[model samples]
Target: MRIARWTVTDLIHDGFVIDDRVVEFPDGLTVADVLARGLSATGELYERVRDAAATPLADIRLLAPLVPAAVRDFVAFEEHVEGVSAGVEGKSDVAPEWYEAPTFYFTNPHTILGPDEPVSPPVTERLDFELELAAVIGAAPGVGQANLTAGDAASVIFGYTIMNDWSARDLQGREMKVRLGPAKGKDFGMSLGPWIVTADELAPYLDADGFLAVRAEVYVNDELVGEDLVSNMGWPFPELVAYASRNSCVVPGDVLGSGTVGNGGCLGELWGRNGSLTPPPLQTGDIVRMVVEGVGELVGAVGAHVAAPQLPRARTRTRARRR
Candidate 1:
């Protein structure tokens, strides 16, 4: 079943999205309310609202299905790693160690936004977009955080959502060279939702070979520049989640992003590898649309900004090289 959080009549509410209609829950509140109640036992809650038709889709604003207790975005796509690493002009060969295991980072939960929300460009002047397919964790607690088998991984997945991880490319290039994970480059606003499809309901979308066949695409101002299939990833979600949970715990509503796909996933690609070649930079009013097959599209518009009158300047030179 597709679960959604929506706003209607100036009030936010929880609901099940079925056949393009929103069926509101009793005591109607946000989807986060249901998640805060612990999604593990919300079956009856969903049933209680399954047939309560309350609002029209056009009148409600959709929010991320879960207000995650924690959000962990994983670098689980090898092509993205290899291609991004190679595309950085002087850095053509990806290190041998990147293939060893799935790595991830914690992002700011407060910056989370919903579809159709406007994204304020950071001070850096080099904003980028990443199309990622994310999975929400179930409440099933695993034993000692051991390396989970494929089946074990499957059982722990609550649902799936499309994530657009907004990035500041210039800041990312400088920080990532240190070999530590991305920090300030990623903490900006991220857009998720429209609806979260539960694992059982999404089974058919899983390929016969066990891989999920989600496709990610990014369009800047109506021009398509990035496109890649989830099937192309080096590691599957099961392995990534299992590896991530090996020595730690993944709680309910935790989000794991599949990471950026190749060719146009970020502004670095448009910036000619290392800010060498001149490419178009996003200006005020530019629209960026990220779409994931089987999920939904996240559409955002860049807004205007005026430079501060007179600000103290900080040194901006660096020599660590791009990763």
Candidate 2:
């Protein structure tokens, strides 16, 4: 099922998509409510939704499928690390530790945007977009599912959605030199949705290694710039989820991103490979569109840059005598 949160006539609603129509869930119920009920009850819930009223998909405004409780984005693509490292940090080889485990960074949950929304980036000259797939967590069936094994982590994933980890490359490169943050460089904006495709619906595309073997593509101003197969990830979704639960817990609405794909997933990789900015950075009014075969398309626009106010610089420290 394709589940969505949308608004019509200024009223928000939760519904599931059927063909070109949206079947509204009964009042006061939501996708979270359905997911909390567990996967076994999906059939009955679908029947109930089908029996209710539906609206034409064109008549409503789509929203980010859910408000994430937390967002953790992982670097699961080796090619992405290689290319981005060479491009942004001038490194040719990936760090050895990257191969030992799946790695991720937390991003802002409050700035999530949905399809067709405009992303107003901070003052930046090198704006870029990361083409990724995001897994949304649902209620776990048993207690103490923490520190899960890779095989068991699959149970907590409710569905998948398209993700755009919007970035300011220039700002990012400057900060990471201190080896601390991709912080403000990222976290300004992220995009998810159109809707969520329940995990069961994507079963046909799962590869032998458990990776989603779907094609992912990215376009800027309607021109196809990058494309890759989702299965190219160095680690699969379950492992990413499992690693996330290592000594920690992930709850329903927590999101895990599949990092950026390779072979054109982002302009930074292209720049790194070619040694020149052939396809210039994103500009105001430029449109970005991403498509993942089973998950659907997510489209967003770049709005005007919001200028930052002058920041006070830190003063140099003076030597002090031991007390």
**Please, what is the whole-model Cα lDDT of each candidate in the order they appear?**
0.72, 0.89
* Residue range 1-323, candidate 1, lDDT tens digits: 77887777667677788676788767755566555444556677777766775566777788767677788887766656655665464564456777787778889888888878777756766766777888887666562356677668877777788888887777778888888757777776788886787777667767767778777788888888788787666677777778777767666677888877665676555454554534466667888888878777878777664343565767787767895
Off by over 4 Å in 1: 27-45, 87-89, 141-147, 178-181, 270-279, 305-323
TM-score, every prediction = 0.85, 0.96
Candidate 1: clashing residue pairs, number: 1
Worst window of 10 by summed lDDT in candidate 1 = 270-279
Scored against the true structure, residue 202 in model 1 reaches a CA lDDT of 62
Q: What's the TM for model 1? A: 0.85
User: For candidate 2, lDDT tens digit of each residue in 1-323?
Assistant: 88899999888888789998998777578877866665657666788778577899999999999888899999999898888888876775699999999999999999999999999999999999999999988876631367888877888888999999999999998888899779889989999998989999998999998999999999998999999999999999989999999888888788899999999899999888877786899999999999999989999999999988888888887667774
